[model samples]
Target chain A: MGEENVMSDDILVIAEHDGSNVVDVTFEMLSAARELAKDSGGKVLAAMAGGAALAGSLGAFDRVYLIDDPAVSNYSPEAFEKAFTHVVRDVDPGLVLTSTSTMGLDLAGGLSVAWPAPLVSYVVGLGREGDDVVATSQIYGGKLLAEVVVDSPHAICALIAGSFSGQPSPEAGSPDVETVSLEGIGPSRTSALAVHEPDSGGVDITAADILVSVGRGIGSKENLEIIEELAEALGAPLAASRPVTDQGWLSKPHQVGKSGKKVKPRAYLAFGISGAPEHLEGMRDSELIIACNTDPDAPIFDVAHYGTTVDLFDLVPELTECIQA
Target chain B: MVLLKQLPDLVEELEPSPDGTDIDREFIKFILNEFDDQALEEALVTKESSGAEVIVVALDEPEVDQVLYTALAKGADRAVKLTGVPAGTWVPTHLRAAILAPFVRELAPDLVLTGVQSAEDLDGQLASLLGGYLDLPHAAVVVGLEVKDSIARVVQELGSGRSVEEQITLPAVLGIQAASQAPRYAPISKIRQAMQAGGLEELEAPAPVDSADIAIAQVRIRRLYAPEKSTHAEMLTGDPGEVATRIAEILRSKGLVKA
Candidate 1:
């Protein structure tokens, strides 16, 4: 009976909270849930998780299952999965979805372990394929897109951020909120000893409004000072390709690429970076792309709207002085 | 101890020939991926610190056995090859279910370590899937690992300069990032022994868990071109002061200058 457990009325979406607050992705996932529920003729449920005051601000859901414990603030897969499993058991949704953030990946992976269900992650598009839900996934470094379906009763999928079009908030936007508490899932094996925030001006370059990206051709670490001066002059954050981060001239947080952050900066200024395909996938969505590299053969010029070929050592100081002037 | 894959003469991005049937030779070359080597180094260090025997596993063409031997020479106690596991014939999800699931069940190692993502695959999803199948705790982008009292302390790299420390129980899986550790060179003596031992345990291919579910529908490469070059160099022809002022004006026009 437990194995064949099924639900027909609701599609559940997990709520992502930022400590005591809610994150934007939670609403994004809800938007996705509402879409799926529309076709399935079901309602959407948002499961709010975290410490006190967390669920209060998260607005409405079909049934807001709240787990307000101090221990739920920091993410622990073991405890969160246990709490989430309990909620999933109670809600019994036909489909479950979460945003494909780092937390989403962890949650979905652990949930797959607990539920033993197939999970489709980083889904780019979702549509109906016959009776099943088909999702498009970018495979082989975005070179190929695959449309896949999990022909199972219970399906778990992770929605890629910035890939899906979100529905506007409901005009009425109020649903019954229920608080569900899990007892005795305690003593998390790991503890968040501390959250050490990096000193990258608080705004991550990958998530910055404006990004000034440097490359290996900057020649030396000292030359980075000129880039920094330009960044300061423009009020832009700094990012780098793998080479700059690998060289230890810039911290890893400022690194943007397939291995790094998927940034969508309003303006991306490339300084001396030879565009690696791996690097372009992460930041091609920038509103404006201006590249500066000495080698005319540098790849960064391909996708750049405006391009400049000049030695960074000579160009940086001049650019900084001009910005100051 | 766990196995990592190295496809001899494989490039990060294979250059397709004009016919699109075979890869171009010029763009293809081989090395133990910088990330996979980092994983191997972590497994070696964990063995040294805990005195647990370490083994290396690689699924590739026969030639890649040398990389496995290189792993042993760098201190892996043994190696296994799930032969016929074609290079590039893997997605992160399927690879874990195929290679790692049975391997984990059979070896039952206290821990399994792998590169966070392979240079060729670059899925960034393998570690979590392997950990999922093992039903074990997993930490990825792990830059640090230490063993004390049979518990593994791992520092996971969460981009944007944040790291989360997780203490996993024994028999957990960890995916090592390239930045996690420096790859160690194989000693000549160990290399000699490993070569003599052959460092290759040819094993039967893993049967697919789903023989025909969700197959790779097709692989289409619309375009493959090297990145184009930049030709617009804003040359400021003047004295240092004049050049600086012109550069400042350019920066201002580019909106790099504020106020």
Candidate 2:
């Protein structure tokens, strides 16, 4: 009974990994959890399924729980949720933190409901205030920031990307890994038939050092050459917003956003891209950001280190000329 | 059935309230959510294929009647306006899902469809929450769906240009990201004709479950504010030549390019 009472105050961080490589968001959640745990006087526990070996590197947590199930080697929402739900029930953590990634969003929705815990998604900030855990989230397409207090005894949160910085734990001690088996988790109502990878013909923008990104304001496919020249002159990769890719002006590999790739280039030159929250979540952490859009009030200006309101059609050729000269 | 919502269009200027808890609604224009429009289009497509009924349910809001009529014009078979939830009130997703579950149960819909996420979604994931309440399987960010023999074959977007195809059992919920094609545009004349036909129905919201009340009380919004701008961007002006020169100079100064 006393051990159960002690476990109730624990904060659980769901570590995301793809069998071999641990996702950066896992470390990011550990950082956020550490801050919250400090104020709440709770221990941070990290949990993962299938990546038992990677658990030892997550020294940030007080304890690490690993669920090894061959059935969960791939990303099955049903299997992962079963493992996570089992861990949550056994540990009874005060707070559960997961990423706002595809898998995270998928698992969080069902888990929050099954646990009957309050869920706060797209969280950008987390803190503790007088016995309550507060989470700040963006709403209205990033125009408004809402401060929400999780009032349930147990709460689950999906943290947005670029909200918190991920740092390895400096505490210099390995986490004790406890392998739990989720055998006989019932059959899933949904079955993943196959995975379709996007056509690979272009540079992967996620690995680019510098990115010249375009959006809807590029107008048409013919105007793409001007930006292409600019990207070539700068020796940077070319990327685009969702609309550009959706229109087939650019391929899926060149798309950068929440639905696309999250990139952290040294410099990101955003042209005609209105900073929607989704797009910003992917490339907001660039070392230097410069945006040029026709609309001065575009949210891209809010995050850009340097910005200009100019028609890209007229501006791109001149900019390319100036660079080439 | 499809779930629709009216949202204050974010394209226009938004001013904060005096208390800074929400946007000032005095001048904001309201429109059907973009994703919900896509969801409606998906439902219409499903109806065409499976001979299913496409019913649109929306909360009572400013100009919502017009939205319902527009959905009708766009090929919805029926429209329902849920009463009792006040307009302009921010209802959390869980409570909204709880309130919607009873109505959905009564409808006995074979499949429930909603937008994957809304522009104003803070706590978000209404379809998933509703699925939980209804004890059904739910899929989010579904880009393609086909219904046959009460089963749904769906293509779910998994971000980073990856997608997964899934076969979900009957009586499931799908959060639509987009349909195979863009939502068809309904001419104003068609909408006017729909309004004249008058197929709109109003249903009073059922009594709230006890859990919904507690959930609402627990989600106390401490404040609402615009995020602080950490960097003051240098806004370049003048002709394209001058701006280009300035950009070149800036780039050269940063050693990103050789002058």
Candidate 3:
């Protein structure tokens, strides 16, 4: 369980890879880690779980650990748990940080169970606490913010994807790369199939610059044609709350919310959405939000930049015609 | 069958910060999450098919008894309030599993069910974390379930638009999705019976685990504010061509169209 060079208090950030590429959240977590490392006088280490040549691509960290094994070919909770458990033991980091992605949540949950230390997920803000680190997390579906103090010598937390916008790296970008072997550590159960990306290419809404969204108030499937035109006119992709996707007017890939993709687009034009708590959870990070709905009292209007009480069916067509002109 | 914790009244009016940051209350009211209602619905269906006695349970203030009463009104054969657990404290999924384990083990239900995540906590870690603590087969975001013999086949939603079917031996934990099944409303007659039955057992609270290792370190308010309002669309009251010109201009300014 002991490694010769493991640092007991180094902050470990488990990097996330989209099978072939490292997700942007990796850098976001690194940015958060840089702050913690500075305060605690600890080093920030990036752990690449899987994928091709990613360990070399991430150059911002002081140390990079590549846990590449034939067994960890895909996103399996068991595989990640084994690899992360090894990393924690090997590195002996005081704090373990990861991006709160689908894989991250699963891995973090497993770590909490495997280790006696405290684990936090979906962290939006972080700072150092004398020797420990404090994190601000959005709980209760973005309705409230909780300040958590992770005092464990071995504390683990997952950073939310757009919590802190990425910052420029001032240090010369050369990091030491260490390839770790997963000889004995392996997943109990495997994915049993190839990893496939959908047609939308798993576009992250949180990172998009512009968004066009449809909601339940958008009315009927025929009405979707108007929003599609709007998206087409703007050259922006189409997104919707859960109801639109459930109706099959839009594919599940286009759904945005706590249950869907969390988007932080520069501009998000939401049409006909009721702004339910779960629906709002995903888009809480968008920079500019616009709501067009019949109900002036819609919860979405409470947080929107521009609000209209006119029926979307009437407004959408009129708006579409105006945009086309 | 699965247990869903009933929620206390929602305090939607509380906007502590004009910017929508920080909660004024030390603890918000408790209530069962909406998705958990769907889990209860799925359990009710399983009970109907197999004639199994489904027991719904919760750990909260007596205010939640009305929710359990509502569950019974919907068709749960039995409902009980789990005592011993403190209200308003952040209960990790593993701790909850530990508390529920002995009781669940004693009852020995064929399957365990709960809402995929709690509404109030929004941790979304319970079902999976509980499964780990129990060391049993578990699935999250289960969209479909079919039980035959002692085996349960479930359709689970993974990331992206993909889904997979997995079969588990009896006694599994499933974190249900809100879209998985439609939650049925409780009939008025059953609601009355559940409220009148009044013999719900309250269990003792489990020991509090020290969160010092995982305590809240510090909180930062990163631009907390209510969602902003969208700009009013300048209505184009003219023919299609004229409207199109205005639309194009707007789209162009928005960088959505060629100028």
**Top-scoring candidate (DockQ):** 2
Q: How high is the DockQ of candidate 2?
A: 0.55
* Candidate 2 error regions (>4 Å): A1-8, A168-174, A183-185, A196-199, A207-210, A217-237, A246-249, A265-267, A317-325, B248-259
Candidate 1 lands at a TM-score of 0.73
What overall lDDT, based on C-alpha atoms, would model 1 receive against the true structure? 0.64
lDDT of 2 at B117: 80
Query: Of the true interface contacts, what fraction does each candidate have?
Result: 0.20, 0.69, 0.14
User: What value does the lDDT take at residue A18 in candidate 2?
Assistant: 53
TM-score of candidate 3's A chain against the true A chain: 0.77
* TM-score against native, each model: 0.73, 0.89, 0.74
| DockQ of all predictions against the true structure, Cα-based | 0.23, 0.55, 0.19
Mind giving the per-residue lDDT tens digits that candidate 1 earns over B126-239?
Answer: 566666656677766677888876788777655445566777777777767754344667777887788897847888766644421221121122333332233333333544
For model 3, how does the per-residue alpha-carbon lDDT over A269-321 read when each residue is reduced to its tens digit? 88888776657767866766767666555667656755566566666666666
**B99-191 in candidate 2: lDDT tens per residue?**
888899898899999988876666657787777777788888888899999788988877767787878887888888777666778999999
Evaluation by lDDT, superior candidate among 2 and 3: 2
With a 3 Å backbone cut-off (N, CA, C), the pairs that clash in candidate 1 are A234-B256, A275-A300, A299-B227, A308-B232, A322-B247, A322-B248, A323-B248, B3-B57, B110-B171
